[model samples]
Each structure stands twice: as C-alpha cells, then as structure tokens.
Target: MTIWMRCFTGLQEVQKEQSDKLQDMKQFLAFIKKEFVHVIRDRRTLLILFGMPIMQILIFGFALSNEIKNSKIIIVDKADDVASRELISKIDASKYFEVSNERISESEIEPAFQKGKLKIVMVIPAQFNLDLHHSGVSQIQLIADASDPNTANLLVNYVSAIVKDYQSEISVPGIIPYRILPETRMLYNPQLKSAHNFVPGVMALVLMLVCVMMTAITIVREKETGTMEVLLVSPLRPWLVMVAKAVPYLVLSWVNVTTILILSVTVLNLPFNGSLLLLFAESTLFIITCLTLGIFISIMTNSQQVAMLISLMGMLLPTLLFSGFMFPLENMPEVLQWISNIIPARWYYVIVKDIMIKGLGFASLYKETLALVVITLFFFIISIKTFKQRLA
Candidate 1:
C-alpha cells in the first residue's frame, strides 16, 4: 500500500475503536440504571442491606466506652474549720466534680441523691482541723452513691486527686504535718458494674440508628430506581406510603430491641430497674423518630449510596461522639457538649440509661422525651415540605 493509504487505514481503525468504546459506555450506563430500579422496587431488602450494618456500627461504638466524669458532687462540711474549707476549695477547683450544693447533715444526702442532684458527698468531720493540728494525719471521708458504679469510682478518684494535690502543695519541712486522707465509701453498686453503665446507652443508640438509617436508605433506593415513581403515581397518598414503609421495620426494630434487652439483662447480667412498659414506650417513640428522620433523608437525597453515606457520616458519627457513646460528655470540651444537645441520639441515650439503669420515671425524663419529640417533628416538617415541593 502507498504511505497515504496506510495512514488512511490507521485513521479508520482509530474511528472504529472510538465508536466501540462509546457503545460500551452506553451499555454500562443502561445496566447501572436497570440495577438501580430493580433494587429500589423492593423496600424490605434495601432496608435490611443498609440498616443492619449501620446498626451494628453504632452499637459497637456506643458499647466500647466506659469513661465517666463531671458528676455532681455535694460537700457536707460539719468541720467548719480552715482545713475543711481548704479541702472544699480543692474539690471545687478540680475538673471532674461540679460542686452543686452544700449540706449540713448526713440526712440531707439521701434527698439530694434521690433527686439526682448529687453523685458524691464529701463529709469533713467537725474535728477535722483539730485532728490535723494535733495528730498530724487527718482523714476526710468521701461517700459516693454507687447506683452508677462508673460515676462513683470516678468521683472518689477525683476527690482523692484533689486532696493529694492540696497535700503536696502544703507539705513543707517547717509546716504542721497535715495528711488529708481520703476514706472512700460507696453506697449502691459496690463493685461498679460495667453492664449497668453501658447497656442502656447501647440499646438506645443501636436501635435508633438501625431503624432510622436503614429506613431512610431503603426509601431513597426505591425513589432512585423508579419504583417510588410508580407508587406515587398510584392512588396512595405520600403519608400512607410512608407509614406502610415504616411498619415492617418498626416491628423488626422492636424485635431487635427486645433481643438487645434480653441479652443485656440476662447474658450481660445488667440491672433493669425501670418500668418495662415505659422502656418499651420510649423505645418505640425513638424508633418512630428515627424512621421519620430516615424518611426525611430519603426525600432529600437521590441515590441509595448517597443516602447511606450521608447517614453514616451525619448520624453515626454524632451518635458515637456526641451521644456520650464513645467519650464521656463531661470529658468533651464545652463547645462539643453544646453540640451534643442538637443530636437526637444524645437525648434518647440519656433517657434509656435513666429508665433502664437508673429506674427514673416520666417526671424525671420529660425534658429528654420532649427534646426527641421536637427533633422528630422538625425532621418530619422539613421532609414533608421538601417532598411536596419536589412533587409539585
């Protein structure tokens, strides 16, 4: 062939190859579209696929932490002397304990403890200063309510550290030898049960995340795949559609919640001191709230992958970090604690812990319950508004 003929042949080959690649691209796009539609058609499978994994992650993260701090502490200064006052100052100065109140007698401790107003009571005996002056070694007793073992142990350690720091600063060769001894006394969970501290928080975080994140992605998958379009084009209103979508997962979540409780109480040997009916009621509300949130997410996002990724990043991370799941809220910076307030999971976690472990009733939990209700309502409103706009 001539040189021109050869160049012409090579150009034709390049054109044909480009055409083939374009055809291949079109086919791949069509395949992806078909798969997306098929997956979206069935809600149950979509929910299970996304929901189960997210639930497991939240549960694992929530259960992994046991740190406690910033517990409310009360001081009963019967001593009313210089040394006792100095010790009280030390307690106040410490980071872990927040001095909520002062009491004059041992009788006042129970009422404050019952009210959940105080976690630790420091008793500075009347002769505390005199003893320090005369005997060189003086003891201050730390009485902690062990109802929450983690808090109790934490309180004792905090008080000891404070007193020790005080002792170190004042210890001089010429000064009066004064040893501030910490006699740590605990009232409730003497051994500081790990199960009691972790179980309630775990149940709340895991169940809520699973129910909400799964339900949201499932709905989004249906929408992206064109199945949701067919459903919407039908006579069924959006509200009824949403309700129907939630019912199955609601039942499944309830079963999962029950299993979690049984395992926590029986296998983990955790205490279930609160009302079972109340716990169930709260759990149900939390699930509903989360499911509503999922629905909202679905209405906003277009693809199941985007929905799933958003939920994992937005919901799971905050639930783990701000819900006091992985880190104690007290240990977090003040800004983070404020940030925790916005997370629905945080309130639910506190509610579950108070109800299941602390045996607190509605009166005590009204604030947390109200907070979740408000958040659920907010998500519902935003989702409804967005969905309606999209439909129009």
Candidate 2:
C-alpha cells in the first residue's frame, strides 16, 4: 500500500512539472508575437528606423561633391592690356565663374561687395602689363565676399589655378617673368576656419528644429491622446493653450541655446565677439517664430504623424539645403537662391555670421532682427486665426 501511494505521488509530480514547462513555452511565444505585431503595426517607427538612414544618405551623398561651378563674378579691370584681357578671358572661360559686370573704378568695389551681388571681384593692377614687363610678376587682387567663406575659398582656388596655368604658359621655366600674381583677401572669415562658417548655421538649425518640433509634437500629442479636448473646454483660449504649451519649450530652448553657445566656444572655439544680450535676443525671436510656426502646423494637422512629417520635410530639409548649412547660397542655382531668400534660416544665418564673425552689433543686425520679428508676427497672427477658426 505504501509503495502504491508513493508511485502515484511521483507520477503526479512529473505531470505538474511538464505542465509548468508547457505554460512557460506558450507565454514566451505569445510575448514574441506581441513584439512582432508592435514592430509591424507601428509604421512610423519602422519608417524612422529605415527611411531616415536612406534619406540622409541620399540628401548628403550627392552634396558631398564640393565642386563649385557657375559662381557669379565681376571684374575691376583697370588694365585693358592684352595680358589682362587674356587673363579675364581665361577666367570667364573656366566653368567656375560667369562674369556679369566689369568696373573701371576701384571705388566701385566697396558698393559691389556690400551689395553682395557677386562672389569674386578681381582688381587687375593699372599697370598690369607694364608691371609684368618690368618686374616679371604683376599683382592682382581677388576680394572675396567671405560671408560664405567656403565658397570664397573655392573661388580663390579656381582663379588662382587659372592664373598659375596662365603664368606657366606665358613665362619661361627658369626666367619666371611675366607672371600674374594672385592676392586673395577674404573679407569675413580671415582665418578660414570651417567652424566659424558653420557654427551660426548650426545655431539656426538647432533653434529652428528644437522649437518647431517640440511645440508641434507636444500639441499634437495632446490632441492624439484626447487630452486637448479637456484643455479646450477649460478657461484657456486655444491660442493661449498653444502659447502655454510653447512657453516651456521656449524656456528650454534658451537653456539649449546657452548650452550650444558654451560648447561652441569651449569645444569648437566658436567666436562670440558680438554682444551676448543681442545674440540671446535675436535667438529668442527666432525661437518664438519657430514655435509659432509649429503651433500653426499643429492646428493644420489632426494627427501627430502628419505634423511630424510636415515639420521634418518643411523645416529640416529646407533649413539644411536653403539655409546654406552644407552648400553655399551663392553656389546654388539662381532659382534655388531666390527660393532660399524666403527661408528664415537664410536671414538668420547672415545675422549669425555678422554677429559672431563680423562682431557687429544691433546697428548692423537691425534689419535682420526686424525680418525675424515680422516673420514671428506673421506666423503668430496666422496661428491665432487658425485657433479661432478651430474654436468656431
């Protein structure tokens, strides 16, 4: 009787262990199925994971070719001699520069440079041919609008290369006389550090992206989750609610701006030669402008997904391309250049460069600052109207 009882208990114990193992296996399979469903159902997640990499590659890959072509230029040809004319002809022939105007007076250089009409303004010496004949080497000045310093450098290089080639062809190998000596004077970026060129661009990009994306996304999130209706029913006006939403991000943006400036100065050696107060003020206007734009986008779109796509495509791509972050505005085609003028970052970039590199104050920056204010007002008004419509 004792052996029978013991055998029955052992059999029951074995059955219980097998049952437990089977249950564990079933739970594991169910969890894996849930994970798979999540990965497949959330299309945005999948797109972000895969599409971003592909898009980044496509956008930046072709832009990697640094060849500057069809740059606008004007010549200050004081010498109409055969040598100077021939040199100008060679410069025009090169695919790099398309010469549109020629000035006889040297005083015209400042106005042309200030107007930013052309990239390179070559000033051929008055005695270009005579000097070459007398001293074997004649000097030519290439004043570049170095606001866009990278483009300026490329232009200088192309012109220098052409001059060197011309010299090699004209001069005897050992004698080395009758040479065109190119002297390049960069206006804005004297040191030619790419950091100086790109840091302002980075600031514009960061300010725009953070403020816009955060404001738009946060508002859309509340709408998506149905919390917006609760807020809408309260004492808060739609515009005020949007403002409230943006205020936190606005404060956070200043914090981020400070961090970026600090890092730029300490780590990247970015020059803050301009007033800190003015910089912060300009940055605030830009942030508010972006925030207004974001709220406007949120009002237009019902879902978080659409808002995100619109902001990414609308702000990010244009800011990167038209804002002269990677490619110089002058280097872009005429149509693109015209289009870039409307991009807020384009204006802000000039402001940033003027501040950080040129070390000019509100005196120089007033127009750009005014432009930002107008943009902010325009977007704010539009968003307010949109909110009113939504309430109606």
Candidate 3:
C-alpha cells in the first residue's frame, strides 16, 4: 500500500506541475506512430508477422484432416477361403486401411509390422470361415503400434467397423436374429471437421502471439534501448506511458482477430453459429489479458530475448496443452485436468468454441467470461504495481 501510495504521489506531484495537455497528447500519438513505423519498417519481422497467419491457415486448412485414410496394414491369413477373401475385400473398400502385403506364416507378422510401418497386423486363424459359419464366431489376432495409443485404438476401431459391416451383409437368415442396432448422431460438427477443432485452438495461439509476444518484445525493446527510463522521467505519468505502449498492439491484435475471422469464414468455411459481436468482445478480453501478461513479464525481465523465452515457454506451451487445444481435458488425468483450470486460454477456448460451433449465447459463457476477466484483472493490477515500483 505504501509503495503504491508513493508511486501515485510521484506520478501526480511530478507530472502535474509540468503537465502540458496538448504536448503530452502529441507526444503520446508520436509514441504510438513510432511503434507503427517500427513494425512496418522491419522487413524480416514484418514478413514473419504476416506470413505466420497465412502459413498457419494454409497448413492447418488444407494439409491437416481428422479423417484417416489408407492406413498401412498387413494380414496373416491361414484360411484363404471365400469368406476370408470377401472380408479382406470389404476392408480394402472401406478406404481406411490399405493391405500392403499378406502372409500365411505367423513368423511374418512382427517383421511386417516393424518394417512396413503398419498400423495393424491382423491374423485370421485356420478354418476361420468354417468356424464362423458353424459356431457363429471367428477369432482373430490384431497387433498394433501402441506408441501412438490413440491412433492405434482408432485403427483397430476402423477395422472392427469394417468387419461388422461385412458380417451384417453376409449374415444368413435367422443366423443373426438378436442384434442391437446402434445409430449415432453428431451435433454441431456432424462431419467432425478438423478445422472445427484446430481453428479455435490456432486462434488461441495467434491471440497469444499477437498480444503476449508482441507486447513483451516491444516493452523490453524500449527498456533495453534506455527509452523506458526516459518515458518514466518525463512529465507524462508512468502508467500513461505504458498505456501508450499498449495502444498500437491492442489495435493490431484486433486486426489479427478480424482478419482471422474473415479468413476462417470465407476460406475454411468456419461455422459462426453465435453472435460475432460476442466472439470479438470475448477475444478483446483475452487479448487484454495477454497484454497484461506481457507487461508482467516485461517487468520481470531485462531483455527482449528473455521476455520472448518466458512468453514462449510459460504461456505458449501451457495454452496449447492445458487449454484442451491438443489433448482433451476430460481424457487427461484428474490432477492435470484440475491444473488446467488456471490457464487463461482454456476458458477462452470454451468461449470461442461455444460461440463459433455450439452457437451458445452469453448466458452459457458467463463463467468462462468471468474467468478471463478475473485473470486479466489479476495480471493487470500486478503489472501496474510492478511498473509503478520500477518507476519509483
């Protein structure tokens, strides 16, 4: 309390006696303009700044897809009967698995799975068709690369689905009387487009880059070049100096949000089921949150490089991981899920996905919005205190 009081006194008493309204305003604008020029004039950084989004869009939009196609698989069939051949044909037609090779010897299974980059190695027993016809069930062995456990599970599931479909098609009358027919309906994202997930996550990353990285870098730049001291010593209040520093970035970060929204809708066919105004407003809050975070980091570090390292390591990984942007929170261990609650981007992602995909209103998003607000206020207040402490 005393620290803040003394800071306020210095800011008020020192600036008030020497304050000139017109000149101060002019100096603020000039400061902002200089920031703009710094961004525009740096050819390498300018290219990277704009190029990053374009590259991200192109890579995530066109190249990445959730639907797995033509997974490599090897089959070891002891029974090369008509039923076995038909099952193999059905699996091939499903487009999810491609039979790269087949072998009768069980010895070939391990080698094929290891060298062939096979997703699954399936072995059909001798008299598999005869056993299915007489006994109503045929046993098979499936070996999969469990290194990527999720993909391995998916591959097995795909194969299971294909086998079931084939089984239903060839079932004799009265042979499969007891059956539980299951129907699935996917809402919001019926097709389960990868973009439906990636866009929001990428947007979170982009917002982080724009606000946190940029603010931290710029603030540290001024500090490194000794201009931060100059600004603090000037007639302008120190808080006002920081505000001027953030203004240009706030404007540019908004531009980033708008541009991304437009591209997402126009090019990638992004679903905007809720109010655009709400989305932008929430994004604004998140950006401010990141900006405040940047200010906090700047106060702790002396150099731009240090700030960059801190931002990348501290916020970026946590945002990507803890935000459910990559791995799901529900699927994570309970302790990890609890820890994810503190990452600001987790709340932002829920807000973005709700508005963009689920079409939920502010009524559903109040908690998430409140969380972001709380985090932002926490960081903002701390950064302000730090700034005042440094100025004093």
What Cα-based lDDT does every candidate model obtain? 0.75, 0.77, 0.84
Full candidate order by lDDT, most accurate first: 3, 2, 1
State the lDDT of candidate 1 residue by residue for 1-392, as single tens digits: 69999999999999999998897666555544554564567687667645654455345435553545466778888888888888777777765667766555888777877887577888777898888777768888888889888768876876877888777766675575554555666533454555555565666666666677777866786787788889788755677667666666676677777877776666666678889999889888888888888888888888888888888888878887888855789998899999999888898888888887778899999999999899889988998899899989
Tell me each candidate's TM-score: 0.58, 0.57, 0.86
- Candidate 1 clash pair list: 146-189
**How many times do residue backbones clash in model 1?**
1
**What are the clashing pairs of model 2?**
136-178
For candidate 2, what is the TM-score?
0.57
Best by TM-score: 3
Q: How displaced is residue 78 in candidate 2, in Å? A: 41
Which lDDT value does model 1 have at 178? 55
